[model samples]
Target: MSSSSEEIRLAAGTAEVGVQPGNGCRLGSLTVDGVELLRQGERYGSFPMVPWCGRTRDGRFRNGGTLHQLPVNSPPHAIHGTARDAAWKTARQSPTEAVFTYDLTDPWPYPGRVTQVVELTEDALTLRMAIETYGDSFPAQAGWHPWFNRHLAGGDGGQDDSGVQLSFTPAWQEQRGDDHLPTGTRVAPTPAPWDDCFGMPGGVDVTLTWPGRLELNVASREEWVVVYDEPADAVCVEPQTGPPNGLNTLPRLVTPLEPLETSTTWTWRRL
Candidate 1:
């Protein structure tokens, strides 16, 4: 039952992944065949978004007849979810797989348990999450935010690819408003450096290619993916159940009978 002090490392085939249950059950590293594919460092890496994903507009949301206020961490809105900010307990672990769990508490206005499973294969990494409620039904969302390296080792191709080029065909892009939240308008796909959300009704399928190096494919059953490539060193492809401010706009429920769940997988090939 050791927590934070222990960092779980999973290795398989040509890939190695580091999981930090101490720091929000996030994937701290991803290295494939001596090539680092994730942005290194503490602030980066891949983290889970549970109970709710993306922003909560002004840090406020109404559940049933009651309204709850959450701390504004993203300035002007409550971004991500509480799970990413809290440490998780190691529920189980193996060589190439691990399970972590945490309970939902105050400020979230719900009673639930969040469980995340990380499975790494020789050529792929799969992540799954579920939120089971202990009390009244409440709105919730699930997702994963991975900050991929804009430039992998020897993947230098200048500005175009950061050595990494993004390729995806989303059904439509969720038009982002000045507030950085989806305006509920679906428009055609736009260009890069996007802080925008896109819809993929047939599921999310995005690829990042590093010329002559590697190609990573991010796929999920979820319909929404947020592409944020504004940072100079990294690009984020987030797969979630809903868009930002979805707590008020989308509001998927987690009940005693049905839990909220979602998963995303990243498969790669050396080219």
Candidate 2:
């Protein structure tokens, strides 16, 4: 185990994870049996989605009768959230786990504290996030955006498979409009190459298999997940508390007494 201001490394059994607290508290790497499961680089890796998940319509939301506006980082919408652009502080740490926290400020309107926990074991990695209000209550969401490598490439990573295959049976896929926001419809599960959200009221259970190389399952208690497999080199199985633009469609309040929390876990096995 090694710790620094920028990142923390945790290892247990055959797994190792590198967490970057400075860069939006994202996981820099996940290497198991020498194969790097996560896509490397700053924009890649697994990052905790807090305060809100996915996008917020036109970067605006309402609390009571007051309407709040957020910076439109993704143009017409505010993708992800403010928490991922701010640095986080390490609250606690160990050889196989760590806890990080950051206070919500500016652009976000309401004040709140977000905490994230990352734990690693031989075969599984668990991630947890919570948003606690510091003052007035506000609508929010939480989740994770993990960029997984589409193909195994290093250590014993030589493989001939084209890419990892996603396997899941989502009850219904949120109808996605041309503008990329859910059109307020829940239709049957559509075809893959999806960059859309799906409903798993039973909880999110999706698997990624790389032929005879590896197999990983991304699971969460939350019922929503955004599967983005459009990229050529990376695939994202984002398990979130709500759907895209959920703040307007499905608001979850974070009051002083009632905090908003969510979690997702990744369990793997060598194939």
Candidate 3:
């Protein structure tokens, strides 16, 4: 629950909100009056990254003839890029908006840093992260991982009793092994425990409704949304451009861009 006095605050009705954008990561924290809307104790995890989510196997990829090896910090693969848990230099800050930037040079596979801007309006919060690659040959993938609490509907107290209901448009599902990595594929129709990614139906907005009719809507400019549930008090409604381990599946599930080229905007707003 520790926050800076100078942190940006936004209000929707009586809600007090805060945003921090640094080191290619953008984060939002919301509270109603003095009670937390999101999970306050878990607020300080990671800035949610440059590549945004996980990478390929071993962080190894081939661009032309050179095989680049990134730091494997996330066990089986390099997760959330290099800047997820990194400290970002604050670029700008105000009462409702904050911007943070990170620059990567030297031997890192990707040659440029990214800038992330987080804005808080009365009803919603938006985070936009952009990476400007210095060279044209680098591969890039980006998305978001936001954890939402069901307690937000009942004022942070009914988190345990509150159940989460999610609706998406996925025709198929990928099966993963014990390592949490994809192995095979299956046609998923019945609801089950999901840590998988799926392609979105065009123009269809995914919604997660809690006990008190409070809903979180995730609309994407990309093709898919990854719905991950831990079956606890919270669930992750991630708006992503590709599947997990996308680096290995680049130019397929992953979106490829050039230097200074930007990806589509992934947005989420509360309802």
Candidate 4:
């Protein structure tokens, strides 16, 4: 359960990003001018999601004619895939960029490889991920789950929707059922407490601004992103290849020749 604390730090202007290669290739911290932007801890920062983005119904999925049952990490559902907590091998590294890779084995049913590349610039950070199977084609998804602090400058450390403002024009929302899985019905965007998925047919683009502080623009070419802001201390704007339970509902098959790739970028500036 312990990962190498060794960090690969990158800095550009007032922005600093820390990546832990051994710890699931997780981003430990993202600070802008000494102000921490990501929540700190096991469930914080940002982690890559591969094979699947969110959750699977009852931890079970029927691919082709075989029924695959994943371990129920979240009680009734299998969440976030196995990559988030898995240790990734550092394939390459530089002063401001790194590449991490993980091979998918048992339980997953498909033999595949997942690769994540992170690049840092003076004003932005870009993340790219892809999955490719060695054998037959299989369903998969890719995304990043970043838990951003509500108060960028370490205000009270309380979990309230204060200071930070979230804005996005979603084309539609996937109505969530009691199981926290999408009900296959798409509705219009509503208010807060949105642990739901939204469709950005135009592309995944969202804005987070802490008035008088800094403004962050999260843009991705992916068409789907989940915005979870019901928490007190932080908010999550997840950009994924598909919605939760998509493995069974909307599977994106990846073959040895065709890999599923997606990218997301976070650009920031002082406001």
Best candidate, TM-score: 2
Candidate 4 at residue 97, lDDT? 86
Cα lDDT for residue 187, model 1? Answer: 98
TM-score for each predicted model, relative to the true structure: 0.95, 0.96, 0.78, 0.95
lDDT of each: 0.88, 0.89, 0.57, 0.87
lDDT of 3 by residue, 1-271 (tens): 1223234445555555665433234355665445444544424322454553555677676666778777777776776666655556677777666666777653356567677676666555566667676655465566676666645544455433656678776666656657665564645644756776666557325676654545556665666556667646667766655566765664322223543222333233344
Clashing pairs in 2: none
Model 3's alpha-carbon lDDT is: 0.57
TM-score of candidate 1 against the unseen true structure: 0.95
Candidate 2 vs. true structure, TM-score: 0.96
Question: Candidate 1, which segments miss by more than 4 Å at Cα?
Answer: 1-5, 155-162
Q: Tens digit of lDDT per residue, candidate 1, span 1-271?
A: 3466468999998799999888888888999986777897776799998777788899999988899999998999998899877889998899999999999987688889999999999999999999999989999899999999888866353444446789999999998889999989999998887999999999999999888778999999999999998998889999999998988999998889999989999999988
Q: Number of backbone collisions per candidate, in order?
A: 1, 0, 1, 3
Tens-place lDDT digits, model 2, residues 39-121 = 99877898877778887888998888998898999889899998777788998999999999989989789888999999999
Candidate 1: pairs in clash: 161-164
> Considering lDDT, which of the candidate structures 1 and 2 is the better prediction for this target?
2
Which pairs of residues collide in candidate 4? 159-232, 159-233, 160-232
Error of 4 at 135 (Å): 1.4
lDDT of 4 by residue, 1-271 (tens): 2356767787877778998867778899998878889999966799998779898899998779988899999989999998877777888788888888899987788898999898998889999998988898989889999999887664455433357899999999999999999999999888897898999989999999988778899999988999999988889999999999999999988988899999999999887
Worst ten in a row by lDDT for model 2: 1-10
